[model samples]
Target: MRRPRAETRWAYVFLLPWLIGLVVFQAGPMVASLVLSFTDYDLIDSPRFAGLGNYAKMAQDPKVARAVGNTVLYTLSHVPLAIVLALALALVLNRVTGRAAGVFRTIFYLPSMTPYVAVGVLFLFLLNGQAGMVNQFLGLFGVQGPQWTTDPDWVLPGIVLMSLWNLGSTTIILFAALRNVPKELTEAAMIDGAGPWQRLRAVTLPMISSALFFVVIINTITSLQMFDQVYTMFFGNQIAQQSSGDAALFYVVYLFQQGFQFLHMGYASALAWLLFAVIAVITLVQVRVGRRLVYYEAEEHAG
Candidate 1:
């Protein structure tokens, strides 16, 4: 007990930098933003108290509804597709080993490491309606592709497709999870006359449920917070004017426009807080649901 005090002191010493950084950089900004959410403050002028005015204005703001709708739609479309694709890639990669696995892993992960700005720019040409690679490939099969950037019906789907480029991290995580499943359990299941599908359904999925849960939450968050690619591709200086109406006006994008372009810092902060609230509620619900779904080997061990 006496020695624990000295050990705890050293632990705190080691943790001091991280604690300081969290308070200074993260917690500080969050608190400041919270306060700013209730006040009017352009970058030029001092903050003026507005109480719930900024938030109340959001109720009547048509753009807020549009932004939220677009974001939710994108999240719905992107999160499941990303997870399924990542899981599929992981399952394929899980069967391989040695140098071949390493090469494939690197190849899949390289696209994710590419900057979103570059991805956005590259995709512009790839998704172009007139003479893009994707259209050319589709044309080979007697199918014509839609104008990805211009048409309202196809614009959001294009964004969702673009979002898949960064599923490499999710794939790697699921791959690691798949590799961690106990071979003995699988072998036992096989001995019991379980077919490939049965064994996978009963053993593999439950074993990796925790990872799937994690990927779902993370991908959902990423989908909701999508900004970089959208901005770089559709909302840029020379491109925004050509965008097909409100199909791509995600919540964060609208927040950026309000805060920077229109100088509505208070309104932007309010929007940020609203998004935070939404994410918090959704995460809480997911956690509640996941508690029953996620299989924990540790819990079984402890029992």
Candidate 2:
């Protein structure tokens, strides 16, 4: 049953590049970062051993606390909304076929494919307080539009809206998952006099639950790491100082401020590790909870 020596050698040869890359690129930096997390390495000076000083400071840092709250708020606001909206769009798209379906799918995905920087800039113009297109359009309706990017009450909402603009990919994934559901099952449910809502609840939902679970998990992780949009749109403005108010001061933004702007590399490293741990725990919890609901077609097939 053993493989020939030549085949074993070929297998090793095929894996050699990946092994080398792992050691040199991934493994090396990961170990280095772990060590750096425990030291004061401000990029300009020699790294000094700090043991747990960075973590201790993080515990008392107001900015860290604010960032954590903002991140949680952003995730709560965006993740569920994105998933639901994407799934709904996907469900609608699933009923269509041929060129129309393709056209609609491409249209939905175009926003996601657009550069984040471009999206940020576009939103900045659209959401501008006085001269922006959105406010101007609202003015015609006799409704006064608040300052979206500038007003504290509206900044987070603006950020959430901007984030949802890129739900096209999620929509496509959900559409594919919906399409993969067996037509025979749906037909059988229909023959049983099941209504549209009943069929969706009993048949469609359970079948696509796994994909839904995956989309939620992915959205949670991505929302936590939101940076480019906030940075490009809001950073270096009066809003940055308004962290006490409606500022979208997310965790990664605070980490960036600590590492580069404030030159607190060791503290930033600790924050990074803490974020990693938090994400790991959340992901594990999601998987555990998801086990109760996720349905695998392969398992059904095997059963």
Report the C-alpha lDDT of model 1 over 221-292, residue by residue, as the tens digit: 888899999888888835643666888888999999999999999889999999999999999999999999
In model 2, which regions exceed 4 Å deviation? 1-4, 236-246
lDDT of 2 by residue, 16-85 (tens): 9999999999888778877889999889999999999889988898878888988899999999899989
Worst ten in a row by lDDT for model 2: 237-246
The whole-model lDDT of each prediction reads 0.92, 0.88
Instruction: Give the top-scoring candidate (lDDT).
Output: 1
Clashes of each: 0, 0
Roughly what TM-score does model 1 have, to 2 decimal places?
0.95
Please report the candidate that would top TM-score against the real structure. Answer: 1
